[model samples]
Target chain A: MTPPETETETASGEGGETRTLYGSPEELPEPAREALGDLLLVLADTKRVLGIHYADWILGSPTLEAGIACSAMAQDEWGHGRILYAMLDDFGMDPERLEHERGPSEYRSSELLDEPTDSWPELLALNLLLDTALSVQIEAMRESRLEPLHHKVSKILDEERYHFEHARGWTARMASTDRGREATGEPFREAWRACLRWFGSEEDELASGLAAEGIVDAAPGELRRRWVMRVAPSVAEVEPHLVQETEDGWGSAVDPDWEGWEPRTRRLRDAPGPDDEAILSRVRGDRNRSLLGE
Target chain B: MSDRLVQIERSRPRGEGTMDWSGVAAATRGDRPDLDVPQWDEPAADLAEEARRALYEVPDPEYPISLVDLGLIYDVTADDASGRVEVTMTFTATACPCIDFIRWDVRERIREIPGVSEVSVETVWDPPWTADRITDRGRRLLNRAGVSV
Candidate 1:
């Protein structure tokens, strides 16, 4: 179904006449608002889960510097997640409830991040593949007509540069070693499939509707293609299905299993998310509950 | 640094009332005047230099050295036409708790400059910060404070 065109009002600024679709959540059409809310939840939950994954590796990483990097990445992901979660308030959801009280089944994170990574190489695969996929989606919203998103996109992307660098550096280093490549190859393939599936099919109504309304800049297929193009250089051997050399440029050949796809959470199955008890204990800071009000 | 240093131009017209800034496209190093090493003799240069110098007055909350010495201030430019001083800075860490206060301090301190009609402070994370960015002076200061670099 074709989404209704966003109602834009013209305003004069230093850059010239700018068109704004919605200044606040109340001004959005119900469908557009709902679509944006779901997208935001997906981003928030994914970041939250990625943060936990990174935190788990803080002590387990092979080197002290690597451990510190894990700690920093964990902090960055949590910060990004908190910022996105706070934006849900504009969409009429209680930020605290969505963050602290949500059960594992209610999480809207990607399936790749739903389970603890088994090895450092697997963590690197998640970092290089899944994290970059999420960033690509956020990048598509850089020029969103929605004001709130437009404001926050730059900061989120700015911080994410380090994440991309850390992942790329490690992936290249690991790819040079036989043992490293062997350990990471399967995880990379798994992450690649999950990321492709996370983008959903071209027929995703919410994604199409959001793209039509200028709330998001690209459709799921376009986003998946961009992500593959970005990641193919480092991981093409491990996941050859990502791209093919076309006359124009590199093109993606994604055949996601759309059957049983959960649209709201953007996963392939109704699996429970990361351990709820551990997530709550870390996210809620239960020990600091006494100091919360102070 | 390569020949492709991103020159971010932020301007706020006088009497706009709002403190909002609009950034121009990143220009090549050759296209823009070099603010990396302020002349300190020119009027605009003096203001920009004074702004950079004043940053030393704003210390990192945790460290004793100035934010300038700490390598927190990345770029500082003065727009003569708009009387706006724009500063691009970054935190030592992504999860810095002092970010808001440091930004506020930077804004307030730079506004103290005479003829400065507006001040804009932007925080960026590109080329993410590390201990190597710290200056020798900052290192000494940190060592003096019983903190190793």
Candidate 2:
């Protein structure tokens, strides 16, 4: 196949070698373009839901500062989602329709966020396990060969540093005591399994195809390793059996069960559960339809 | 700060109406310039400076210090030919509640300049805003405002 004549940006990669980057979505190979669009939709949808999940805990948090942090993180998620959704028009998708028209069966966020976190421990689990997974995945695209997105990815990663500190700080605090640890243990395990599976498995066509195209810097297994290494130090103490410290770095003791895993949506089901619809409705601004200028 | 210290690009013509976020790819650093637009020699750079000088008049809602001095304005460049000034900026935190007001304030302030009929404010998060981005003038202003930098 002949390369289409398109302006390709080049990134100064490690070791001083320059790698070609796709300047626009139209320039990408068919499979890679589809994979990237799918991946981005999943991420944007999850950020919107995750923002609400964070917002749910803002008022009742254990500390004022923690509640404030939740408020801030929630805003960041919505802002991030808007930026991503705005760019979907280039992928032949309508940004407004994607954000407003989707139903529960159409959302691409994880099942973990299918409902509001029931307790502080559950929210913390989503923070350390689920949020960190999203960050690590974004980190892999910091030098994405998809040129337009690489800088945007870096911007999102910079904003996420505080989120990690928030998660790590709260995780250590909760895991520090027997009572705190016991309350957080089950939630962490459930969250870990879901997030670990979110990266998909070795044979995932979408994950592997994107890797070959250099859209995401690392492959699925590598991304999972980064996710585990990121979450282990704070989360491992409480869920000792769930995480394993390797000779070199970190590992997960329980491998992901792929029975219900859906690659495109990165969830157990094809879309969010019915319980997730209420908040998803709010994300669509169903209540304030009259106020929206658009 | 490398050899490519100059990330400035000549702005292209646009409709003068509507005040929303605009594309920064042409004005952003390291992007290949749009071949169709004629490069502005020097007056373009000067117009951007004029826009920046104007921002000193707009104080942050919470603080008295100018937004320029506070380091919120990332990059300011103007196209004298098109009368458009593109300002790339960031907030101190994602949760800054004053962002909407700040953005409106920015557009209004830039429009006050004589050669600036169109204003574009693009917000970025990468290399997130830090105290180090604040200018020495900002420090003195902050000090005067009873806030230690």
Chain B superposition TM-score per model? 0.70, 0.67
DockQ, each predicted model: 0.08, 0.22
| TM-scores of chain A in all candidate models | 0.89, 0.95
| Local accuracy of candidate 1 as per-residue lDDT tens digits, A102-127 | 67777888877766778998899888
lDDT of 2 by residue, B67-116 (tens): 78778887788788999888877777654666655676778767877867
Q: Stretches of candidate 2 above 4 Å error?
A: A1-5, A8-11, A270-277, B1-46, B94-96
Each model's lDDT comes to: 0.73, 0.76
DockQ score for model 2: 0.22
To one decimal, what is the Cα RMSD in angstroms of model 1 from the true structure? 10.5
lDDT of 1 at A82: 70
lDDT of 1 by residue, B9-72 (tens): 1111111333222121112111233222223455535667778887777767666677887898
Candidate 2 chain B: 10-residue stretch with minimal lDDT: B3-12
Task: Tell me the tens digit of each residue's lDDT in model 2 across A1-294.
Answer: 455666454547577776676667888897889988988888988898899989988899999999999998999898778767766777899887888787888888889888778899999998888888998888888877766677577667778888899989998898788999999999998898899889999999878999988888888998999899888888777788898889987899999889878898788855446363568778887777656554
